[model samples]
Target: MTQHVNEFIQQGLRVLDIERAGIDDITPSINQDFAQACELMLNCRGRVVVTGMGKSGHIGNKIAATLASTGTPAFFMHPGEASHGDLGMITATDVVLAMSNSGETSEVISIVPVIKRLGVTLISMTGNPQSTLARAADVHINVAVQTEACPLGLAPTASTTAALVMGDALAVALLHARGFTADDFALSHPGGSLGRRLLLRVSDIMHEGERLPKVRHDAIIKDALLEISRKGLGMTAVVDDNDVLLGIFTDGDLRRILDQQVDVHTTSIASVMTARCITAKPEMLAAEALKLMEDKKINGLVVVNKQQCPVGAFNMHDLLRAGVI
Candidate 1:
């Protein structure tokens, strides 16, 4: 049993080594042809239609999704469906990106004539440069691998990896050319956690109004502790009569005071609070606020307005509950 387990591990490692080498071999293929392919897609007035068959189709689907999320309008179309009637999805203004290991997929090649007739820009990623698909394309990206990870060399292992990496290379290159920003990506992925982190503001999840934890600077530590407990924010903002931020008191401060044997009822919060503390604007991004808390080694922040008045308060637990952490 031990020998069998060791053999299994060795086989997995060997497969990984071959795939890595295949990826390395394709690095040189990122040449003029790759740049031209990106240029065609970047300048495209319509979407990029990606099509492939079998294993290549799966990779094509992922490539299309990546392109769309990164600011390039793209979608996957199966080659088999294209011949049956889905070809209408392609427009003259659109660019057709076809993937095939051998560059001779019959379904893919069968549509080459129609693609050319429509005057659509054709970009082909294939292992065989001399194959029909490559010869018909305006731009051809070579994704040929020396060998497959499969011992039989019949499966589309290393070849598919090379093609997928090339597709990612194209998408990222176009993303840079278009100056796609993180904000733009967030817009496309609004339903995901990434979008929540980018789009949520400090005011969105902060405890405001009566829920805000705050106390007057003249208030004793005991009073601030009560406010903190009532608000359940683990901290309380120290403010002046005008509601202007003065300082902050937290559980950590309470610990220090207890060790010093200070009288919570007589000691004013201002005297024991953090005078020069980190604060966040209500309009600031939640992700930015989270980073500030992490960098300053604090667990909470007081959200203030332009006048530096405490308007809201939140802690690490708030961010976690809001899925911003």
Candidate 2:
């Protein structure tokens, strides 16, 4: 478009490239120290106490959260606050993870002796391995960056990104070590959309009781059509005397029947309904139900109990409203 706009775009992409290359440079440090740090946290019986100063504090906070959500229990502790009585939050069995780009933030360094005295394992992530904090820690993982994304090289850009990605790498490593599943993750994030998809069941959103569009197998086509219209599910389940789902008659079936000019008043629904319809169970995960609907090229499903009796019914619209779609 314009020269100034092109310069702005180029500058943004340049910064991104610098940050990505900085991340790539961090790969070699995922060696012994990193493994030992992960092992220390994994075997720990108590929580991980993460501490930092300034921008590192912000990155440490996010790291702590990622670790907690991924099955490694952790929390952020401001190093300055920790010296002022917050140190009590850490137990002898706990592990302390400290972040400092220079490996020499005074606030974090001042509390190292107390952490050591408490007999807590210390892990340090720093841009300089030879810094004081790294030497004091039981394990040190270098997060050195080759360049800063900042044009003036005065801001915490690439270094902070490296630390954040390192933290995520640690969290996911622990998550896999514990065999953490999506169900476990969902429990920790029940308010999020992922939780809804994993935790919700067919029975939770399905229409049951009188809301179900169902009719006897011997019921006339007109009766089934009335049930479909009343239930508004675009389909009707044909059931036997015990309410076991025998077949399904959908609007598609109605279209075919109309083309044949079948007498609605005289023809039994069982004669034209599609038997052996795909069905879902009441306890089936809502996400799984959606997969079934998609793979079978259908829009709705009937939830049946163990006895093959129709318990509930739902369609894609129901899943959309439930946020499972």
- Maximum-lDDT candidate: 2
**Which residue ranges in model 2 land beyond 4 Å of their true spot?**
240-244, 295-297
Per residue, candidate 1 scores C-alpha lDDT tens digits across 1-325 of 8769988999999999999999998999999888888889999999999999999999999999999999999999999999889999999999999999999999999999999999999999999999999999999999999989999999899999999999999999999999999889889988867889988899998999999999999999889999988999889999889989998999998999899999998989899999978899998999999999999999999999999999998999989988897
Q: Using TM-score as the measure, which candidate wins?
A: 1
RMSD of each: 1.6, 2.0
**Clashes per candidate, residues 3 or more apart or on different chains:** 0, 0
lDDT for each residue of candidate 2 in 1-325, tens digit (9 for 90 to 100): 5769989999999999999999999999999989999999999999999999999999999999999999999999999898789998999989999999999999999999998888999999999999999999999999999999998999999999999999999999999999999889999999968889989989899999999999998899999999999999999999999888899999999999999999999999999999999999988999999999999999999888889998889999999999998
Work out the TM-score per prediction.
0.95, 0.93
Q: Report the lDDT of model 2 for residue 135.
A: 94
lDDT value, residue 279 of candidate 2:
98
The lDDT for every candidate, in the order shown, is 0.93, 0.95
lDDT of 2 at 111: 96
Q: Pairing residues by index, what is the TM-score of model 1? A: 0.95
